[model samples]
Target chain A: MANFLGLIQNENMKIYRRNSAKVFAAILIGLLLLGALIVKLNAPEHPTQDTHWKQSLQQQNTQYQQALTQMKDNDSYQNYYKSQIAINQYRIDHNIAPDRQMTLWSFVENATPIMILVISIFTIIVVANSIASEFNTGTVKLLMIRPISRTEILLSKYVSSLLFSLLCLVVLFLFSWLIGGLFFGFSGGEAHLSYINGAVHETSWVLATWQNYLLDAVKLIMMVTLAGVIAALFRNGGLAIGLTIFLMMGSNTILALISQYDWVKYVLFTNMDLNQYFNGQQTRNDMSLGFSLIVLAVYYVVFLGAGWLFYTKRDIKA
Target chain B: MGINTEPQKQPAVKLEHVTKKFGSKTVIDDLSFEIYGGEVFGFLGPNGAGKTTTIRMIVGLMRMTKGNIFIQGHSVKSEFKQAMRQVGAIVENPEMYKFLTGYQNLVHYARMIPGISKERIMEVVKLVDLEDRIHEKVKKYSLGMRQRLGVAQALLHHPSVLILDEPTNGLDPQGIHDLRNYLHELSRKEGVAVVVSSHLLSEMQLMCDRIGIIKKGKLIGVETVSDFMGEGEGKVRFTVDDGQSAAQIVKQKLSLDAASIESDAIELAIEHEKIPVVVDTLVVSQVKIYGVVSVTQSLEDRFLEVTGGKSVG
Candidate 1:
């Protein structure tokens, strides 16, 4: 077991020592910090004026009171009271508590797919290349002849790639947070932003507090693991990363087309993100949690298993 | 897995009709030989003549197409772990992580072999005389230094048998000389069975106790340096009076056609007793005998004959 651990450490050192990987990691961290700084600096201040709904109600109340006050001289009190009653009745009928129409946590919940969509596309390249580079450089043989089992070597690579992916996410989140906070502020207001009707609206929804960054890190790890498995099984980093991006991007289109079939939702990439499951979003096609979990497990197993089997049985002569 | 109850073992390595093929090409064809305990046995063969393939099979890197290889009486196929436990090998080229320091590479390999100690690593470092440069990364080391480091790594576990394939491939003349002397001391003083495979006959002729010549995947011959020199093993040569008459007289008396008369000398390929008989016959024949000398066949002639005059480059 110690020998195995030593081999794993050696494998990890090889990855960490690479100049290109180090540069990539540094760039990611820089981008994340930059993004966070930008967001922090550019966040708009909350509107100081009264809300439109509140202003409308105030205006109605003022108009009604003035009319009643002038009715003693003009005999308009009864008509003015009737008008106020009519206005109140209209409010009641329309149920216009528009004051309570702030963005909810539910909005952030629905946006989990977008979050995974944005991050995983970039993650595919990092994860895939981490393993595929060994094959490309003919360094796999050096690692294999160390009396360590193939499974251990593959697992070490998988774990290291996962760490790299999480690091990338950390960089991105740090930059996004800094940027988000710079334009916005450290305050939770406008944690979620949306563009509707050519106007950018700040949402009160706050999904990632500083503490939730850990969970974000774990989620990034899971995504990278999926990509790492694909990378290890594929010929090179490019194909693995390209295919992973294709799956993430084409997932919605595929789901739309496959929704006509009863069983297709179980395999959709959008459904694979665990946060999506918690959100109670409707699938394009109905898929039970049990079924999706099984499918994902199968995929994880096949990807990991195929990588191990191929690496072990491969001719290391080259 | 019982120890051979026999009191003493004859040889450290023995290959019994070991045949191996890669696809349709026979890389090693029905090879059989032995290396006795504590001797530097040289395995001489040309490029693509199955030296590397045989070493790989012996080290359990590749399985044989047929037959078995035994190290210290443990079968390479069936008892590989046990057999490998006693044997150390560096086949073809010696390569290590250029990024790792010499000490790091040695320690890494040391950890793989069970029961290896840090002290053992230090010992090997000193043995290879790389103590000063051991901490430097391999990429900074010269070719000779790297080869020494390779030998150090292979010897770290103190395996009884060391197999080196073309150990001097990339070294300068001084480096080769250093290696040759070092290997000789290791086998002679430490009593380790060292098997060196090379195409250079002169080195083997100088270094090996006995040699096995392989050609086109076949073990063509195995002979002691003396036997390989043929019937001229310790026999005296004669520059005698009337060299042709001496040859005729000796051949007529002994009834053997082993004497060849040159212009100046007669080479009497004779047993110890025949030397006395030849001198008396020449004296009785009234031939003016000028000199009596012993000539042995050169290593080149022996090598050429053993390899059947096959081209070696």
Candidate 2:
């Protein structure tokens, strides 16, 4: 166990020492700060005077109803509008504030998807190069000749990649929160209002945000594992990163095109977005959170299994 | 076969009929050899003769198709970790993480095995004479410096067997000399069984105590440096006043084949003991001999002779 931890430390040292990794991290945080600044600057000069919660809620309901009537053919947009309308109606009926103030929690909630996208891209690049660059640089021989088993080395690398992804996620969340709090007030304990199961439900902002972050982390985990498998099989960093990013960015379009098929729900991308289920917006009527979790579990095993097999059995000729 | 009589201590590295096949094409045939402790064993072969392949198998980087390798009494196939703990290797090239500093690379590799102390790392750095630049990033290091760092990393664990394949690939003359001296010192002082593969016969002749030559994926010969060079009869070149007369007298009196006679010299293929008799016969025959030079065959010549004229790369 100590030896494995040492290996993980070694892998992490290798990752964090690289100039490119440091630069990538800095750019991610800088982009978050910039995003927060833009949102703060775009806020209304007199938020409380011009935009009352009750009045804004009523206006948003009317606008959603108008858009819903015009977009009857679009099922996804209709579902989104219906959920928004339901949430607005609930807030109006219960006399709950519509969360007009941009709090730190709100900024985090709004930026969750963007944060996931950035972290996923960064992790995919890091994980893809982790194994492939060893071969490219002929350093695999040094690693293979060590006293530890091949499985241990590969596992350490795999775990280190996820740890790096987790680090990025934490950094993004904390930095966004800090920047948002500095610009917008750290006030309000507004609950996350959602429309689920043909009714309205309210959840704590922290709880809902944590669940969203966890689900987003799952998508990044799948991408990292897929990148690792590709890197191990091909031993080319460029190809691995290219393929993983391509799959991640094209997932929505690919799912839409293939969603008509019954078996498409079993595809990795179709089940990646666990947040949809929580938001009462299932991309497909058949996809539940439990079903998506099962599909992701199977894919995670296959990706990691194939990667471990190829890595342990390879000849390390380069 | 009965050269060293040290009560036959257990060999540090032993290969039993090891064979490696890459998809039906056998790269290493049934080859067996043993390297004892406190000796520099030179692995000599031409290009593509399976020297690297054998080294890879010994270090467990590449699997052997059919056979077993034992390092310090542990089988590499079954007890890889145990076997590898007793072996250190640098195959083909000494590639390291260029992004990391030399010290960082050493520390990273040192963490893999247990009981390696900071003092031991410092000792190895001193051994390889890299203490001056150990803190610099590997990307800024020269090839020779990187090679020394590799040696230092390999020695950090203090393995019983040290395997270096083409270790002198990119070293300058000074670097190669230092490395050769260090390896010899390592073997003598620490009793580490060092196995080095190289194409430089002169360096091997000077650096190795014994050598094993392979040809076409087979072990052609294994012998001490002196024995290998002195296996066959040597050539004796006699520079005389009359080369033609010396040749005639040598042929008639000694009844030996005078290999060549050019200008004022006659060369004959004869054993070392036969030189005095030939000299006496030539003196008695009134042939004034100015000089006699005995030429012993080099390892390159013996290697060619044993491998059927195939040259070492």
Task: Kindly give the stretch of ten consecutive residues in candidate 2 chain B with the minimal lDDT sum.
Answer: B1-10
Model 2, residue B271: distance off in Å is 2.8
* Model 2 per-residue lDDT tens digits across residues B1-313: 2223222368889999999888988889999989988888999888888898889889888898898999988999999999999988898889999988899999999999999999999999998888899999999999889888888888899888899887887789998998998888778877888899989888899889889988889998789888887775489999999988889888888798788888798999988898999999999999999999987778788788788787677
Which one is best on lDDT?
2
Error of 2 at A133 (Å): 0.8
Kindly list the per-residue Cα lDDT of model 1 for residues B98-206, writing each as its tens digit. Answer: 7778988776677666678889999989977899999998889987888788788778777778988778877788878888898777777667788998777777778
The CAPRI-style docking tier of model 1 reads incorrect
lDDT for model 2, please.
0.86
Return the top candidate by DockQ.
2
Model 2, runs deviating above 4 Å: A47-78, B1-7, B169-178, B238-253, B259-266, B276-291, B308-311
Q: What is the TM-score of chain A in candidate 2?
A: 0.91
User: Model 1 — TM-score against the truth?
Assistant: 0.68
